[model samples]
Target: MGLYDIIFYLFAIITIASAVVVVNSKNIVHAAFSMLLTFFGVSGIYVLLGADFLAVVQIMVYVGGILILLLFGVMLTNKIVSVDIRSGSIQVIPAIIALGAFAAILFSIMTSTNWKSESFEIPTTTSVELGNLLMSQYVLIFELLAILLLVAMIGAASIARRDKE
Candidate 1:
């Protein structure tokens, strides 16, 4: 295999392993940390896929922002560590059925989609292009995302504070 394949496989393995632990781990903190590893591994794989921008975005948004928020949730919600972090007698069968149905739909969509392959000459400057595109075409989307994050932070803080009273 090539360097890309090696790196991709390594990252994929880390991502899957961490993701499994993220869902199954007994400690909430460990689960949060495993999610962090999963996000980092996925971001690394994105970089290997020749999407530097997407990789940076995955790290920044998922790892830096979302994972931190998740960690905060885990920390703030639980005052003391419980013996069994995971709930017992969970409805796994229904979840599996739902996921299987969703997966089938996704597979069908993937098979049906006529994806276009674009060939592009490498531009000397991409950062400027991307910035310009975001500003000119998607500034509203950026503003909306900022507002969403602000709202989430405020809501989480309010909920956390409510426990005090």
Candidate 2:
């Protein structure tokens, strides 16, 4: 109907389609590439929602950092990266039960929750405010994330080293 609606739907479709590709692709490399497209679509949606900082971070953190590392790991490994996806109906009963439980919980939440209908103003200085909050209110959590990333990098390096020896 409107330009915003069209753009939102376009991004949504791209995100969902790419996500499906990422999930269903048998080749790890292709799946990783599809994940990049999905991330890009999500980042676009974030930008549309006036979350520029989040959009940039999504691209940088997920596409640039994690996805690159995943691709590198898959490419550099000696073992086979492509996995055969099995669709056996061995757990049909359990799957049906789980789906039913999930649907019931979702329905209950949707019916019971008081959803907000009011529109909120988007702050122009979102990045500045976010930066200030990270430095002031959430410094510890920020530092912990950095430390966790460092530890993960070290672990990955160690694993790669072991593979060589």
Candidate 3:
């Protein structure tokens, strides 16, 4: 009905559609590119939620860094581009049953919940406060994420090198 609601729905649709594309695409490069759109949609949603810092970080870390690296890895691999990605549907019945149950539960939760209706003021300088909190409170988690990424990259490099040789 409102402009914000329309924008929110638009971004949400873009994010969900791109995520579906990422999941369904057989080509690894196409999936990686779809992930970029998904990340951009998420960044737009973050901006709408007044989380500018999170939006910037999402673009920088996911779109700029991880997606680029993943694309390069896929492109650099020999004969990987021509490989057909086959997805199995062996658990179709179980998946349908699980999805039905989940839908029922989600519907019930949405109907029964007492939702809060409030407007939030957008902060002008969110980066400064977010930076302070990350440094002071969430520094350990932040550092651990960096370490985890480093380990994962090293592992990937080692696996690629082994495959090449």
Highest TM-score scorer = 2
> What is candidate 2's lDDT per residue for 1-165, written digit by digit as tens?
999999999999999999988766767778889999999999999988989999999999999899998888776663545454222236668977998899999999999999987878999858998999999999999999999989988997887675544
- Candidate 1 residue pairs that clash: none
RMSD of each: 3.2, 3.7, 3.4
Which regions of candidate 1 deviate over 4 angstroms? Answer: 81-86, 108-114, 118-125, 151-160, 163-165
* TM-score on alpha carbons, each prediction: 0.73, 0.77, 0.74
Where does candidate 3 stray beyond 4 Å?
A: 76-97, 115-119, 146-165
Higher-ranked by TM-score: 1 or 3? 3
The sequence of per-residue lDDT tens digits that candidate 3 reaches over residues 51-93 is: 9889999999998898988877776663666575333346768
- For model 1, the local distance difference test gives 0.81
lDDT of each: 0.81, 0.86, 0.86
Candidate 2 segments whose C-alpha is farther than 4 A from its true place: 78-108, 163-165
> TM-score: which is higher, 2 or 3?
2
